[model samples]
Target chain A: MVRVALYTLLGVMSVVMVAPLVYMVSLSLQTEAETLSAQAVLWPENPQWGNYAELFVKAPFGDFIVNSFVVAGGITLAHLLFDPLVGYVFAKFRFPLRNTLFVALLATLMVPFFVRMIPLYVLMAQLGWLNTFQGLITPFLMDAFGIFLMRQFIQPIPDDLISAARVDGASEFTIYRKIILPQTKPALAVLGLFTFVFQWNEFLWPLVATTTPEMRTIPVGLTLFNQEYFTLWHLTAAGSVILFVPTAILFLVSQRYFVRGITLTGLR
Target chain B: MSLSARYARTAYLFLLPALVFFTAFFYVPIANVIATSLHTGPQADVFAGLSNYADALADPSVRHSFLVTLGFSGGVVAGSLVFGLLLALVLDQPLKGRVTFRAMLLVPYLTSVAIVGLLWRNILDPQLGILNRLGLDQQWLNEHPLATIVGVTLWQTVGYTMVLFLAGLQGIPETYQEAARIDGASAWQRFWRITLPLLAPTTLFVSVMAVISGLQAFGQAYIITNGGPGDATDLSVFHIYATAFKTRDFGYSSAQSVLLLVVIVLFTLMQLRAGKRGEVTY
Candidate 1:
């Protein structure tokens, strides 16, 4: 009886979690007229693939996808290249303000994004960066959270690896490239995947920073779709499913790394 | 060059990019926010003292927005955590087809917040929603505004919080439970005394994350209710957006933003304090 109850609970929770996503896929494939009808069908009676086709053909969705790709890609590369390096410096080097710098990174975490959004907007405006790809990419490139995560992962590595590389007359850059970077591959992958997903799904900042249709990322584009298709349930669901595909693919591929990232969150 | 000097140079080289971004994006903008809040008028380059904050405080809409934010945040945090913990406990038991169930549970967490908002808005729409199809034709948002929003947000987030708890539960060593069983403890007693105490760290983690996220509850309010039914669910972030963009009151918005920062920071400090207490006891 106890076992049955537990299974039932898990089953119900699983359904609750995935039902909306399934509903999205279902609605996306439905013809406009069918979707609008009072007769609700869990699965579309006829699957029309043209919704995805119209997204690109009629709207600037292709531009949105490209913009998202470029921005998320840039942020991921920046995080992977810079995070571990800074993490290494903070972890290994005996710099004068090492502790202070590390503490500063942690301190920034406390200042919620709400506090910073307005100022960030003004700063972007002042720099003439608003409505530009630079505005979308630069602010997000090197997250404090990524740096902190990398630092934690790097701290546990033995110092001997670095010393041994140095003893063989490796340049400092060479030592980092040859020794530290290779060893921290797992951390880098996790950080990269995280930065990518976050950049892709980000809404408020992109909405605020970008003005033109060209500058909008996937989330903002989807928001625009929502606004334009206010009463069109099928199109809204289709847009959402379209947005979900790349993120879902990325999540599935990097799920193990994603799990690792989640594990590290509990560490601090 | 000496090896130590070379390494130092390398370290700084590695640090430059991240430091530059952080300074420009994080520190500089935050300083700008502080400056803008303290200044007012056409240029906003002139300094005015405490006027914006004073105005923000005096504005009833701002106060009402804060209250609405509090109500929404409170409901989301409480509802998600309770349901999440219950689901986690249930899933922790060894069961058939658990892996698939676990993956399904994580689907909600992976779904974009915008998509979640859009999906739920339709799900609870007074007229055409599937909820109506089940013969439960009620105005989910209009009738019980806070409850409706909270219910949807909880539905989206509970799975996420549950997975986190499940990870924490699985981390607990089996020996502790075995020892408790040997001592003739009842299942309830063992859970209360042994399991709960051990789950402190996870609880602390969930508390800080949930509260911080709760205080920043904007997406659901923005996409679903649009802070409607007469500002019933206007979160602070939404207010900041409106004040800055809609009203063009940059100074006033900055001050309001500062209020949100203060609220979150205080909650974080409180969580840290409670977490530390648990650490000491353990």
Candidate 2:
């Protein structure tokens, strides 16, 4: 009897959790008239596959997808290259003011992005970067969390490996390039995926940073769709599906790493 | 040079790029925010002192926004915590399709907030929404704006909290519960004594995170209600955004941002204190 109750509860919660996503796809496939009809069906009698086609033609959604990829991919690549290096040095090398600097980096983690939003926007405007890719990507190129994550991941590598490499006349850069980078793949994967999904889903900054329709990322781009077609549920749903596809695919591909990343970063 | 000295030099060289980037983007911008908050004018360079803060604090709309923000965060934190813990406990049981359920639960967390806002707005539409079709005909985004936004946020976030709690739950040694059972403890007693105490760290972490994110929640409100029904759902972050962008009051917006910074910093300090108290250690 207890077991039955547990399953039923789990079953219900799962349905509640997943129904919105299912409904989103279902709504996207229905015509506007069908969706608004009194006898609206959960699943459209005739699935309007044409809504997806119409969305692409009406808006620069294809450009939004491309822009999202460019921005997310750029941030991910920058972090992949820079953060690990910073983490390696902090983990393996000792220096004056090292602890202070490390603490400073960690301190930035507490400074919420919204606090910096206005000034950052002003800074971007001053730099002539508004409505530009650099505006979207530069401020977030290297995050405190990425550096901290890398430091934690890299600290576990034995010091002897670096010492041995030093004894063998390998330069510090060589040791980092060859040894530290190779050993920290799991951490790097987690960081990269986290950064990608974050940048891909980022709304506020991208919304403010880019003014032109051509430069908008997927999330910000969808808001335009929302404004222009407030009543067109099918097209908006289609746009939402487009916005969600990349992050969903990444989540599915690296499910375990994504969970591990969240736990390690203490972020959702 | 000594080996230690050489290592220090090399390390500084290695750290140069990140330090420069951070100084320009993070440190300088934060400093600019502070400076801007104190000054008047569009450029925000002219010295005006605390009038911007005075105006922000005195504004009824700003005060309403603060209350709305608190209410939204409170609802989300409470709902997500209770439901998340329950879901985690349920998933902890030996059950079929556990992995699938976990994956399904994580879907909303992975989706973009814009997409979530759109999806939920569609789902809660008064005329065509599934909820309305089920005979719940209330205007979700208009009349019950806070509840609607909170419900959407809870749906998107509860799974994340559940995952964290699941990790916490699994980390708990089974012996405690088993021993409690042997000692004639009821399930409720065992939960209260063994489970709750052990899960305190996770609870603290989850709540702190929820509070921080909930306070800064803008995307959902922006998309769903546009801080609508006469500012019924206007949050602090959205208020700040409007002050800066809509009203072109960069100084006042910066002041509001400073206030938000104070709130976030306080919560973060609490988290740090909790960490120091060793409650987070399992």
Which stretches of model 2 miss by more than 4 angstroms? B271-282
Q: What is the C-alpha lDDT of each candidate?
A: 0.80, 0.88
Q: Write the per-residue lDDT of candidate 2 for residues B1-282, one digit (tens) a residue.
A: 999999999999999998999899889989999999999887777898999889888989888898999899889889878999999998998988888888888888888889888888778878878788767777867778898899999988888898899998988999989999999999999998889888887888888888899999999878888898788899899999999999998998999999888877787787768756756333
Predicted model with the maximum lDDT: 2
Q: List the residue pairs that clash in candidate 2.
A: none
lDDT of 1 by residue, B1-282 (tens): 985676667777777876787787788888988889998875566688999889888999988888877787778777766787788888788777776776677767776778888998888887767767656778868878878878877876776788778888898888988998999999999888978888888888887888888888788777888888888878778888888898888888888888778878888898789788877243
CAPRI-style docking class of model 2 based on DockQ: medium
Candidate 2, residue B160: CA error in Å? 0.7
Task: Pick out the ten consecutive residues of candidate 2 chain B with the lowest summed lDDT.
Answer: B273-282
TM-scores for the candidates: 0.96, 0.97
Clashing pairs in 1: none
